[model samples]
Target: MTLALLPRYDEPRLLTAQMELIDQSFGIAMLGCSLAAMILASGLAITGGHPGALPWAATMVVACAIAHFGRLAVPDRLTEARSGRYARAMTAMLVLIGSLWGLVAWLYLDIRSPAVVICVLSLIAGMSAAALAVFSACLPVAVGFFVPAIVPVWIVFLATGDIAYLPMFLGTPLYLVVLMIFARNYARVARHAIALRFENLELISQLRDQTARAGQAQRQAEEANRAKSVFLASASHDLRQPLHALGLFVVSLSRTTLDAHQRQLLTHIEASSGAAREMLNTLLDFSKLEAGVVTPRPRPFRLQPLLHKLENEFAPQANARGLVYRTRDTTATLFGDPSLVELILRNLIANAIRYTRAGGVLVACRPRRFHVSVEVWDTGIGIPTAQHRDIFREFHQLGNPERDQRKGLGLGLAIVEGLARTMQTRVTLASTPDRGSVFRLRLPLAWTAPEEAADPQIAMRLDGLRVLVIDDDAAIREAMAGLLAIWNCPCRTAENEDEALALLDDFPPDLILADYRLRGHRTGHEAIAAIRSRVGRRLPAIIITGDTAADRLRNAHADGTALLHKPVVPGELHAAISTLMRESEWSRAEQ
Candidate 1:
């Protein structure tokens, strides 16, 4: 397609320059041809015994040759003087000169003499041909071909004999065939050149596209790393305030005599501690999602219990926000990673509750032929049609101009969308501005007969779990250990492999948690390796780090390890610990 068009070579300025270069060569050939013709004509004119004819013939030849030489001398000036509209005019002039010379030689000199006239015609034709082949300047290719062929025919036909017309007519078809062959060769070469040019252009375009994509990916990676750092610092600062308060409250309660009200206030302080922990966890999870560190493993899961849990968790929050939060169950098992689906619904509900000033939010699940559609319908500050996709992008908060004051990091929906994509599920949004919005989750329903059904009500419980935590931050290690202790799991802290190795002498951990970056000559991976080597068993370890570097994340994945980010919340930590422990137990049973 790109080769479909060719550049203009016949433009005036370039053609002019080319013509100028070969003008002198053309002039010499023209002079020789004219001189030869004059000689031939002088002989012919004298055979009829004319006294003035020889001089006249010599004068014509000398005058025309002088004109040709003068034209050659000032070729540059001529080209510039008539640059724009010169091609047609110059072509016409050349034609006129040749015709005039032919008429003069034919009529006055030797009109009826075939032999003498033929000799003159040959001179003229030879000159034209020499000019075309040698010069190739004054005219275009078509003119070059036409001039040599046209001149001889014109002279021969003007001889006024039947035999004279024969040479002219016979040469006509041969000239045409020669022109066709030249044209074909020219087109083939031009076509090949065009095709090669187009291929090069296409390759360059593809290279540019690839370079742009790589640059974009690098920028995204840097931004995600920066955001992760910000999340870590903010989570640490925010969580520390409440954690410090809880520590003080506990210490004070233990030391002093406290009234019932004071003790009750301490309990409230503890609840605030729990909330702060959850917020920290949410921040860490959101950071991981933004860093593209979460990989989904889809499995068949019960839809009803998951939905029920979300409803129970959000009912009070929705009520506090004066919004009706309800669920209509499909009462069928759905096939997906239930944890991811739960997270999606959680964020959807949280977003709904945060934005809705009044009216209601509904969590409805409906069964299709082979799949179930889960919808989160909310009467809230629904996104404008144009802003619908924008809301699903990271750090994009619409409607609320002062987004930093909102309840979220503006990453909840982004995580939901990312997770949905990983699970190969479509998340479609339908909304009316300032009225309502509906987010739908379409998933295949896993078939379970009535006979196979057990007690549908399920509870998530984790007890008697041992988790090993290795981090450089003493505060985070102590804090995580305290949180895990509260969740009824025993946790041991380590700064690096040496510390972890020291701990493993007395107690081998059921599961391992290590940081991506560890102090001198060690990493979380090395710690896990050391522990595995000592115990002579594969330990399910999760790398917990504040580093949101893509290379680190990739390394963790390549090594077949799980990960968690720093400033982790109590609930998510509990979940991660529980999951790893359960997986370990499953492995043990299989063994």
Candidate 2:
């Protein structure tokens, strides 16, 4: 019945932990019990001088030694299968030891000496207290030892039926009850402590798992970003190659003698090509901004020239659409990346020209004491107040549901916002329906040296000047050669470095033009470097590429080589080649 009252654990791990705790302290408990037994037996032998007492002392000592040694012989690591059996065996051994102690109490009670009876009762009480402390981790084991040790002694006192023994007989049961209560309370405390320890361990395990999962997710996101960059790089290059060739072909065709109708057709072709190039550029700009590769190079420059450039570029478009175009110039010297500022202004003006079907557009700069605000006001179908915020989002256009490519890819304003952020500034917008919209870009004012005059336009004549062109694509090579031939420049072409070097040995050209990415995983820079080494002279060179990857753009900028993006404008290409040739000529003359 006492065993039934002992605490029962539902968790297998908790039960195993209790058994382990018992096993760890088993030796200490046995040693203490053995010492106590020896002391009691010695006292009994001296006072009672009973012959049976001596034999009983020897039996108790042997029993304790057997129990202790038997525990030591069990395996160090208890498996689940053996843990229950081991616990039961420990309980049985403790009970046996307790019974042996009880025998001492029963036998000594017959001696009829007051001193011997006191000693017997004291020993039984001490043994019960020791059992409570030792076996508390496993409550059933404590109960098994405690009941056997005390019940026998209490029964003996009751049988005596004397008045002196009556107080003890009545008191013994109450005393037993108090000890049982202490054992049960201690058992609960031990169970709670073990439970808390396991709970902490489980929490730590879960935390470690969550940390690992987060790290894995972070790595996967980084990998996906890298893959996206690679795909965009490949696609940009592949798509631009044909566009570059076609632009060159059109330039070559325009040089031929043609009727007025044919000339008008060429103009239309150029317009379509120009529109396609703008869309492609917008896409590339968006990609670069998303990849965080656009850096601003700011300098103090006059706003008049930049505003005038915008006016010149858009005035014709505005007139063609029968909308008024005007500009108010200020001599305000603003500090910023001039090219980026121009990009923002260009997009704003372009959007205005595209959206305004009736009213004119105004481009103006207002100077303040500390800053200048460049504003673009359009009298087009004004933006709704609800969509004023959404207008800046990528690929979002108002009133162009058919997704017209001519109105642009809806990325112009997005690029404008991104560029403003790069410049550490914000773009302001104001609009009312059926009225107009205004975009104001504010910039800090700066004082600087007077601006230098633009470089004088050099003669585009390339007659008798030998030029080398190297490209992997056959069409690009042929188109480039034909275009250069139209300028009366003698040209040589190659498919790779080896072919270029072979061409150089026979006809060393005055200028070298190469594609950035070449076959066999070679770069145009390497080819240029090799040719310069072979020639023993630093030759003027240019790197033309269609790659819009952020890293590639950064590398190209760092290389200090003259670069042109693919589908290059005929006028721009001619200008770049002419400028490099002039610089080369100046350097040679100085030598």
Candidate 3:
């Protein structure tokens, strides 16, 4: 009966909790009330002169004794498995007790003394109210007690035609009905609360599982990214080796005598190699930027020469493309790395030209109170407002659906942004779709103008320069020797550090061009250290390498050597050596 009254939710825990609540119902307070009621009712029966009161009282004492022991034993048996049997036994007990109390109430109606009858009635009412408190949780159990007990009291009042007992008969049944309703509501609340608790627990468990999966996925993604980085570095190094040697050989061949037909073929070859070199150099620039090897040297510098240099470099391309590449001159002296600023402007201009098919590109500078804004304007396919931020991201391009290598790898603007960030400046873009976009670079203002570098003579004397080329590759060595011969500069080539050191006695190199990675786990830096130590002179040196690894690049250029990556341009190579010779310790101290 007790089990039937509990709400069924198909959850084992809910049923178990209900049984536990029912178990708590059989405790000291409940048993004491029953025993006290039995005693007080028996006393009233005897006071009203009823002879049957003695036996009834004795029966009640026995029932109360049995209930006391049952209450003590209830907790041990109060499990779901035992709940059914336990509930039936409890119902039978309630019937017996309720019948005894009803008999006591009936016995009171026969008492002639009004005061004794009143006392008996009071006891019956109190006992029934107590049963309502104790048994009302289960409606079946309440019904068992009330049917036997309340019906008899009602029958006696009606049969005897007693006006005094009418109120008791009417009000007692109503009171029991109210208690059943209250108990029903209480059980509903308990059931809902239990269901809610389990639901919350299930949700928490799912959340934890999702969190674990997400963490694992993140770890896997990070590992894949690292693997990608390693592959790119390795591939870049290998590809640069051959291209570097090929570029050197091409430049060396260009200097030799050739017929007009052969010269044109050579020109085509130069163009092809130059395109490849440009792509590779772009990759190298991105790698250096990623490795944080590119640092800006900000100083007060005139902006006109930089603009002129860019104009000269891009003007030919603009003329070939039939696009007007105009630069409005500004005497504004900006404070920033001229080389970095040039690279930024170079990319922006190149991008402007590439995107602008029929229209022209403009470069101008605007002076402000504390800074100068260098703007690159173009009349090409403009950008959408939504993609302004995305354009700066590496490899994100617009309108180049074919992924043309000529337009670049989409890293030009990324590199520009990186250089700008390194120089502590910003690049902003404003555009409308189908129209040209303008990219503006803000640079700090300079109070004093920097000294201009003297323009390189059409021919710089390399007559007295004795060069030593240290490389493990035979082709690179031969190419360097051939290229140096074209410059009328005597040179010696070595396959290893030992061979190079041995040649020092006869060759006594005035300049060292050493490949970074050499045979015997040796590096050009180490070879140069040994060479300087042996000759007791700080020779002008350059560490030419094909390494694109971030950590290696950082360590390679740490000592401030004139480091150049593989596939070096003959013009740039010549200029680097010239600059080194002019400013080296040997030139400054000895010359």
Candidate that would win on TM-score: 2
RMSD of 2: 4.7
Residue clash pairs of candidate 2: none
- The 0-to-1 C-alpha lDDT of every candidate, in the order given, reads 0.67, 0.85, 0.79
Across residues 349-463, which tens digit of lDDT does each residue of candidate 1 receive?
8888888889999989877898888999999888888888888887688756676544666777887888898788878999998898999989988765323445543334656
Task: Give RMSD (Å) of candidate 1 vs. truth.
Answer: 10.6
Report lDDT (Cα) of residue 471, candidate 1: 77
Query: Which candidate do you rate higher for TM-score, 2 or 3?
Result: 2
Angstrom error of the Cα, residue 261, model 3: value is 2.4
Ranking by lDDT: 2, 3, 1
Candidate 2, poorest ten consecutive residues by summed lDDT: 5-14
Clashes of each: 1, 0, 1
How far out, in Å, is residue 420 in model 2? 5.5
Model 1 lDDT, residue 376, Cα: 91
